[model samples]
Target: MDRIAFDIAHLLAGGLVLVSFMMIYQDRLYALLNVFALHAVLLSLSVSWQAYTQHAPHLYVTAAIALIFKAIVIPGVLHRIIRQMGIHREVEKVVGVGVTMLAGMGLVAMSIVLMLGLTEAADAFAREDLAFALSVVLLGLLMMVTRRNAVSQVVGFMSLENGLILAATGAKGMPLVVEISVAFSVLIAFIVIGVFLFRIRERFDTVDDVALEDYRGEVE
Candidate 1:
């Protein structure tokens, strides 16, 4: 039973990392949002599995928050925002898909090497989960760096947070308050970024980060 539970948890965590890779190659805004929603769904499942295997019920609330807010509400709101701003169909890319994917694979390899080395004395489950979480986080950073759109950058930031949540829940004896705090912090970030996106659109008539940088006299 323990081995089975560990395998399931590993599968879900790996699924989250896989979805992060999928997010990297999405050039269209709507498609990126859809993939992000899928990422959140995978995260929720992973967290719920952690809750079950660890017998920690508060993690369920964390999973539910991921489902309701990250998976549904954030994507829905971002879709509407992009539609209203008239950039729903715009395709934005700052790096070639091949390069970004190769970089992502390197990050994953680095994560596995670093995590396994650091956690040599830790349980196998936690070590694997932490490695996957680090990969997700690094991939999210890569996404943010390789996208010129503010909306896509926001998705990347949220994906990074998903990795943090996964790492927290994977570690045994994590407090409920910490999980709740992390969830609420992400909610606050989403709200702030949503408003920021509108403000950017209002001033520059687009959400391209390059435009905003030029407007601020910053050379990109």
Candidate 2:
């Protein structure tokens, strides 16, 4: 690949990682949801650039899917869910912001080291993309574990899926059918999770996982 293509891809992938960090750093549910939207937008742009550089037209459809469903539709739905649930206060964090940020930095470093070592035969763009993608995925998982709010956890899950799509598009010849299947599966998960969130709120009067734990303890 040319220098320009490589640099653009690097920039977009790095932006996704940055947005993932932003999501974890956010204390409010609305802020986290906004950052998640930005993450999806970055993922869509990165995939579009990948499609251009790789000369794969099918990947454009994947980009569209990310842009439409993830960036716009999903975030909009999440905003409404939070509104209906009346959860506009700051979300409870299992870890401090400083600790979570330090952990995220460590995850990014580990991903870079691991991907570079394992993907020695891959091209520079692919290697870098995979590294950033893994970083985003790890950060998403970290966010999910460190946030007590159910809505925030859903955002984390969606961000993790963004990373998976990034890695898939970065590698050559990922089947469009598989990408479609993954997208649909995510949509299904979103629907299920949304329903579950409302149910949790209805039962416990709060959308925090701790309520579920308490209920389980009582049942036991």
Candidate 3:
């Protein structure tokens, strides 16, 4: 049963990483946000499964945070902000999709090869978790680099934090790092989103980051 549970957690974590890859490949702002929301939900499930495997009930709290904040509230707020600002369309990409995807594939391969070498025999779950976390981290970076908009960059950053949380939880004993991180990320995510949304609105009258950068104060 323990082995089976561990395998399930590994599968879920892997699924989350795959979703992050999809997010990297996204073009539209709404699609990116929606993919991210799904990514959060999958992370929650993966964490909850990890909790079940490790017999740590506190992780349920982490899962709850992921669901409430990432899956529901964050996306909800972003959707409303986009609607209000009338900017619900594709964010500009700095690089072409094909090139970005090729880069993303490099990241995913590096994650698996590097992490598996580092934690070769740690355990069934730990090795898998590390690989997935690394993948998520890389995917987030890819998303950040490929997107020209600040809002999309923020989304990528938040998703990177999600990967960090996954790594912390997968370690032995449900460490202090995971618990503190969950709380810290929740606080940071909400605060940053609120501030950015306003700044985005104030400058461009839209949540589009490309426009805001263009509006940055210039010599008269």
Best by lDDT: 1
**In model 2, what are the clashing residue pairs, if there are any?**
none
lDDT measured at residue 23 in model 2 versus the true structure, 0 to 100: 86
Candidate 1 segments whose C-alpha is farther than 4 A from its true place: 176-193, 202-220
Compose the digit string of candidate 2's lDDT tens values, residues 43-150: 889989988988998888888888887888778876776677776457778789999999999999999999999746887778888999999899989987887776
What TM-score do all the candidates reach, one by one?
0.87, 0.87, 0.84
Model 3 is weakest, by summed lDDT over 10 consecutive residues, at: 201-210
lDDT of 1 at 182: 63
Q: What is the C-alpha RMSD of each candidate to the true structure, in Å?
A: 3.5, 3.2, 3.9
Instruction: Quantify all predictions' global Cα lDDT against the true fold.
Output: 0.82, 0.80, 0.78
Q: Clash number for every model?
A: 0, 0, 0
Better of 1 and 3 by lDDT: 1
TM-score of 1: 0.87
Cα deviation of 89, candidate 2, in Å: 3.0
Badly placed stretches (over 4 Å) of model 3 are 119-121, 190-198, 201-220
Ranking by TM-score: 2, 1, 3
Worst 10 residues of 2 by lDDT: 198-207
